[model samples]
Target: MHAIDVNELYHILYTKLGPRHWWPARSTEELLCGMILIQNTNYKNVDRSLANLDAATNFGLAALLALPDGQLQALIRPSGFYKNKARYLRAVLQAYHDHYHELAALPTPSLRKRLRDLPGVGNETADVMLLYVFMRPAFVADSYSRRLFARLGQDAPYPQLQAHIAPTMRLNIAQAQEFHALLDDYGKLGPDVFGLADQYQLKL
Candidate 1:
């Protein structure tokens, strides 16, 4: 097997799928809220949950802080894990002011560490937020990413997968964001079963 060129994959997907327009956040606060809401859930459910929150609290940070836990849980029920998610969202809100700031003011490593220290933020989540929301150079290694890379004979641990893409590409914010989105959309649009082309152009 040959090595999978990360940039080649990125370009292939970009050319095939065009723009996926991912992350789906209009503001920094919205992105932070989505970071908590999107845990272990799909975008459809997250969109519904966000709509509920928007209608209920106008997506205001103070309103989110003011909303009772039970109410918060109810509003975000569409995304699942409502109770834990509510707590996680609040914890993120508590930390956002301190750890999050203008992108120019903070380094990627420090911001990533601070985000990871917060509850409910694992490696994948931290990297996603860094890459999409903070516009940093972090390759988000999700399950789809691993599966795609593995097919190309680049099987590795999560951090290793990130490393594999990080050095050669050094992808900027737009490219990194588009690459992640393309991987996810391609995985979903590709065949459900593995080891087969199944109407998709993604070669193994």
Candidate 2:
């Protein structure tokens, strides 16, 4: 155990693992698709699904919004749970079209509320979107984070976990983004494999 804080863990991971610059996308819509599609699945499948969507719509958000439900479902089928995810995507697009007159301009907290109000967006997804897309300093308390922290003798509900872990990491937008990516990516290196779990005991 390092007996460390979140900030120190971030530095260690950053030095060892290098930069992530995660949520790989060239546009907000692509990022939206990514955050939605990546749920309950890995990135490889999400990449294939995104490629299919690009082939179908030439990488245009308007074209995606106009795509029929069945076709949208088919294009993203490789991501698994296609029908539900298609509906989720449609709901998000519809929300954007109907109400996104100035959403990106809102404060991060307000933006998080709106994102969470959408059909499939949860706290984790909303925070990721906020951090990566809207350039907000929001830390994502995702499953990987929980697992990693549990191993460190710290486990709680999301809000409690957030309170426990966030204060130690004094992060701005870029640092918040990198910190979260490191927690998740390093945590994925489980005890049996190449992750951070087998290497250290984090009592803090």
Candidate 3:
């Protein structure tokens, strides 16, 4: 496996795919709910679940929190794991609403810690919230990124990979968010699309 230049790869993906405008949420509450509902499911399911939720709550976290477990579960049933996710959603959103102001005051590291402390927010989910929701510079070591780099022959643990890419790839919040989106979008494409099977030897 050859060494991959993180910045160079970012440029390649950006030039090829252009702007992704990702996270695909109109509000922070929707984004957070999507981030949780997205676990163990595809975006299709998440979108359907988000629609159901939006119709019910208009993307209000407080409204979502007010829903009974069964009702919430039914709304998000399309996302799969509805029972567990409903519980997680209630717990996390309650914490988010109660600590909303306090979270805004936290420095990035502390903020990430606080997010991770929420019931369903894992490292990747915390990073997503940090980057997209909190508008912080965070490298999300999500599955897409892991797969992309591993195929490029530079596999590493989540923290190590994130640390490796963050400095060079995450110049600021906007760039970080774009870079992450590009990686995921590229990962979703056919391997032949980017010639990643040959370790990113460009076809065009």
Cα lDDT, all candidates? 0.77, 0.80, 0.81
Task: Point out where model 3 deviates above 4 Å.
Answer: 1-4, 196-204
lDDT of 3 at 44: 95
Per-prediction tally of clashes? 0, 2, 0
Cα lDDT, model 3, residue 78: 99
Compose the digit string of candidate 3's lDDT tens values, residues 95-138.
77888789979998789888888888888988998888788878
User: Where is the poorest 10-residue window by lDDT in model 2?
Assistant: 191-200
Clashing pairs in 1: none
Strongest candidate by TM-score: 3
Q: Which stretches of candidate 2 lie over 4 Å from their true place?
A: 1-3, 192-204
Worst 10 residues of 3 by lDDT: 195-204
Question: What is the TM-score ranking, best to worst?
Answer: 3, 2, 1
RMSD of each: 3.6, 2.7, 3.4
Of 1 and 3, the candidate ahead on TM-score is 3
- Which structure among the candidates has the greatest lDDT? 3
Clashes of 2: 2
Worst 10 residues of 1 by lDDT: 195-204
Q: All candidates' TM-scores? A: 0.85, 0.85, 0.88
Tens-digit per-residue lDDT, 25-141, candidate 1? 666667877878888898899999998988898777788788899998999999999999999888877676544554336777777777788898888888987886677867888
